[model samples]
Structures are given as C-alpha cells and as structure tokens.
Target: MPFVVPRSPELPAATWGSYGMTTLAVVPLIWRRRAPVAVLAAIVLIGGVYKVALDGPGQPLPYAGLIAFYTVALQCAPRVRVAVGLATVAAVALSVGWKTGTARELLFTLFVSAAAYALGRLQYTRQAYTEAVEARAAELERANRIEAEQAAARERARIAREMHDILSHAVSIMIVQAEAGPVAVRRAPERAEAAFEAIAETGRDAMAQLRAMLGVLRTAEASPRSPQPGVAELRELLERVRASGPRVSYERTGSVRELPAALEATVHRVVQEALTNVVKHAGASAVDVRLEYGAESLTVTVTDDGRGPGGSSSGGHGLIGIRERAAAHGGTAQTGPGPDGRGYAVRVVLVTSPQEVGT
Candidate 1:
C-alpha cells in the first residue's frame, strides 16, 4: 500500500523506504510494556532516520511515537518519565524546526503527546483503584464466612447441651422409677402403679421437649412455639425428681422478680443438670434447690446429701455445659463437697440484666 499525504514541495513523495521505516517504528511497540523507554527510543530513532534520510510522506498522526510515549508514561518511574519527557520535548522542537519551522504544528504535536500521557496515567489510577476495591471485598467475604462458621459452631454446642440435659435427666429418672416399679409391685401394688405412671410421664415430657427442638431444626410449620422451660417450670422438674425417691426441696430468697427468658431457661437447665448429677453419682436421699436473686445477679444452688463429688458427675459434660452457660451469661459455676463436706453441691451464679450478658 502507498503512503498518502498532500504533495508539497517540502514534503517528500511516498516510497518503499518510508513504508519500511513505519513498519520498523511500530514493531518495537510489541515490547512496550516490558521496556517502555527502550521502545520509545527505538520509535524516535527510526522516525528521525526516516525524516532526515528518506524524507518520506509525513504521517497524519505520529501513531507509533504516541503509543510508545503512552506506554512509557504508564510503566516508567517518575524520574525516568521526567527525563524522557524533557528529551522528547527537545526532539519535537528540533524536528519541527527542521521540517516546517512552525509554532502551530509544534504546539499541536505537544498537546497530542501530553494528552496520551494523561490518558496513560488516568488508566493506571483507575486500575489501582479497582484492585484496592476488589481486595477489600475479598477481605469482607472472608470475615463474614468466619463469623458464620463460628455461629454454626455455637449453635451446635447449644443443641448438644440441651439434648444431654433433657435426655440424661429423663432417662435417669425413668430408670430409677422402673427399678422401683418391680419392688413396689412385690410390696404395695398402689406404689407400683404410681412408679409406672411416673415413668410414663417422664418419658412424655422428654419426648415433648425433644420434639419441639427437632421441629425447629426441620423447619416444620406446626413446630411448637412454646418457650423453653423457665422458672415457672422448675416446680414440675423438682416433682419429677421427687417421684424418683429423692426428697427435693425448693427455696427462694431476695426479691423474687421475673427474669429474662434466656436467663430463666439457663437457670432451669442448671438446676436440672445438678439434680441429674445428684441422682446419677450421689447416693444421697435428700436434695435442696435454692434460687437467690441479688441486685444484678441470680444464684442457683443444688445441694444433695450424696457421697460427695465423684464419678462422671465431677468433671463431665454436664459440668462443662454449666460452666459454658454461666460464662455466656457473664457468670460462674463452682462445684465441690457441700457444707461440712457431707455431700456434693453445684452452684451457678448468672448475670440477670440483659445488658450484662456476654454475646
């Protein structure tokens, strides 16, 4: 293809040499990103040679030079860019003087070069901003995923504690009643019927609580909406233990006011766990449950006239769950021999105010 430009006495005609020079000037652009300054230098040198030696038809635009300059502006350090820019300005001035010797052409060429440089810098800024935004988004996604996993773990622990307390207590009571049922049948038929009835009642209660929990897990529409066992349910819980042949007593101190539902539920669970330990480990005949409400705390104490803290009840999941529950509520749990070291006692102090509870 022929190079086309207006025929002027000063402008040389298009030649095969001019086309070859143009191709050479553009070829170096392939390595522009890796060695931008070198690429620009090559283009300038080729263009200068084509101008002075061949005096070929002038390009409408210095496309090769502009592209190389843009790459340099984008990829080079500030010191290199400044040094190259000054050299380019001197070259532009000399080229214009040697060609048309006109200020208008020189200004136009400078403006075009500056625009290319500006565009290169603008592109660099935009890319940097985009990368920063993407990095931040990734960090947030990781944080959210971690939080979700932690929440899932906490929920699983809670479910395990609930199931253990419910099933363990229910099964222990039923076992005791079932064992007594045969003995009572051989002695008093009336007591035998009561023991059997107690077993059935305990089983039904456990099933109801378990079903309620599983219903929520299954996303069932008809899931029982009843709140967890709270203070109002403590009496019934004591009665169940009483049926298993233990003399259980309940006492309250301080201002007996309604507490938060969560706190009350914890209270209920703590008492149940303690009584279970007593029934399972302690061979005591009598157990006492006391609730003492303080200014900003509620203390639950379960003391049994058992054989002291030994066996699985000393450091079991039951005790661990109690400690976890207390810590969650910004409270504490203490266990050891009861007063005078006669039996075992588990006491948990729980924060009552909602604001005081830990997350």
Candidate 2:
C-alpha cells in the first residue's frame, strides 16, 4: 500500500457557512449614526468572537471593526463615546489575546482604535463647518430682501410727493382763474381775457412739469439733468396760486438762503397744498403766506379769513398727504381754525440742517 498521509480534518459544511455569514455580519455597522450605541455594541459582541475563532488573534475583519468604532466616536455623546471606545478596545484586545496569547496583538488593536478616533473627529468637524456656512448664507439673503423692499417703498413716496406738488398747485389756480374769468369779463373785458390767458399758460406749464417729472420716473436711465425743483421756483409757484381767486400776499423773513433740493421741494409742496385747501374749503377773500428761514429749519404758514367749509377739520386726502410729506422729512404740520377765530390756517415746519434725507 502507498503511504498516504492522513488528510487534515476538512471544515464541515455548516462551519464554512457560519464563517461566510460572520464576514458579512458587520456590514450594518455603517448605519451606526441612526442607532449609534446599539449598532456599536452588536458589532463588537458578534464580530469580536467570530474573528477570534476564525482568524486567531491578530487580525479582525478590517473595514467592519474600523467603521463601527468610527461611528460610535463621532455620533455618540462624549460620555457614551468614551464608554463605547473602552468597550471596543477591551473586546478587540481580549479576542486577539485569547487566540495569539501575545502582547503584539494588543498593540495592533490599540493602533486601530486610535485611527478610528481621528477619523471620527474629522467627520464631526466637517459637519459643523457645513452647518455654519448654511446658516450665514440664509441670514444674508433675508437682509438683502428687506433692503430691497425698503428701497421700493422710498421710491413710491418720492413719486407721491412730486404728484402732490405739481398737481395741487396747478389745479387750484385753474379753479380760481376759471371762476374769476367770467366775473372780470362783465366788468373789465381786458382783465377777463388776461385771466383766461393766465389759466391756459398755467395749465400748459403744469403739464410740461408733470411730463418731465413722470418721464424721469418711468425711464430706467438717468435724465439729461436733475428734475428737482428748488426755492428759485417758489416765485413761479406763488404766482400760479395768486392767479387763483384768493387775494394772496407772500412775505419772506430771515436769510433767503438756498435750501436742500428735497427740503425746498417739500416746502414748496407744503405751501401749495395749504393754499389749495384754502381755495377749495375756505370761503375767504384774502390769504397770507409767510416763509421763515432759520439757522436750523424752515417754516411756512398759510392763513385765510374766510369761513371754512362746514365739516371736520380733516379736509380730505389732501390734508393727509401733507401730513405724510412733513413726517417723511422729520418735520411736522398742523391745520386747524385760524388763530383769530376767523378761518383755517395750515402751518408746516421742517428741520433742515446737514443730515441724510429719504433714507
């Protein structure tokens, strides 16, 4: 008989199947963030025993053990992290030590534990930085939206003020001149024709100014020149109102100095709105207009002796608009019965020194 060496006992079919199953068993550890401590514990208990029995001490399943350790380190709270880390280190060390019975087995286990901790810290830091960047970007977008809305609101206010200034003054004069033209025609034909002509001229001038202002508003591009009205235009404003029915007198006090474009326009508008109300509401024969310029402010007062239309002092949208204009400029307006108990008086005072406007 040929000398046949006794064949080493072959692995049983059941034992081989169990070993294959054990290799795949650690894969679920990757989902440790969803169930950190539980996954970690399960992986260490099952895989630690399997590796000791299968591969004897020094080597464990490479990716599976590393992933479980890293997940526990990153996802668990500090106290839980410490507990999981110690448990994993001891389990791995004992598994290897039982098989190899050597110090080198423990050293290899320690090295893997250290690498897992470092990787976990890196992942945690990366997540924190990403969250912070997202928060900052959201805040900036909200601020930008608020600023854009505010800018649009300011533009609307500017357009309203312009309309009030040009239309009110023009229309008031038209009403008065139209009313006076026929009266003059009966007594003085020459004066009547002049009044009619003034009416036409005022209408044409108002239309021109309105068209210019509206054009500036409609066009996206800058105008050939600025469309702002200043104190220099006050003379023309008064002349138009004078052409209306009320006998008007204008007096200026203090230094007749140049004012800011916006302030000048606002003052002009205040006076115009006041006189318009006078023409419409006050059944007076004469009106007095006063402009006072001081070191720090401009003041305007329009008074009439005629009885006002019997109603609440709240004239209409016109009065509300005047108040809004004054408030917008950090100023104030008051309209009530005249001081002498005769008619209505509208007074506006505007603070006008070097300061930011329309912001």
Best by TM-score: 1
TM-score of 2: 0.83
What's the lDDT of the predicted structure labeled candidate 1? 0.88
> Judged by lDDT, which candidate is best?
1
What is model 1's C-alpha RMSD?
A: 2.7
Give the per-residue lDDT of model 1 (tens digit) for 1-359.
24343466665567767777778888998999999999999889988887677766645248988999998888889999899999999999998988899999999989999998998899889888999999999999999999999998998999999999999899989999998999999999999999999999999999999998887888846455569899999999999999889899999999999988888899999999998888777877999999999998999999988888664366479899999999889999999889997788898999987668644
The whole-model C-alpha lDDT of candidate 2 against the native structure comes to: 0.74
Q: Which stretches of candidate 2 lie over 4 Å from their true place?
A: 1-19, 52-60, 99-108, 222-225, 309-314, 355-359
> Which pairs of residues clash in candidate 2, taking residues 3 or more apart in a chain or in different chains?
284-306
- Estimate TM-scores for all models: 0.90, 0.83
Local accuracy of candidate 2 as per-residue lDDT tens digits, 66-89: 787787777778998888777777
Per-prediction RMSD in angstroms?
A: 2.7, 5.1
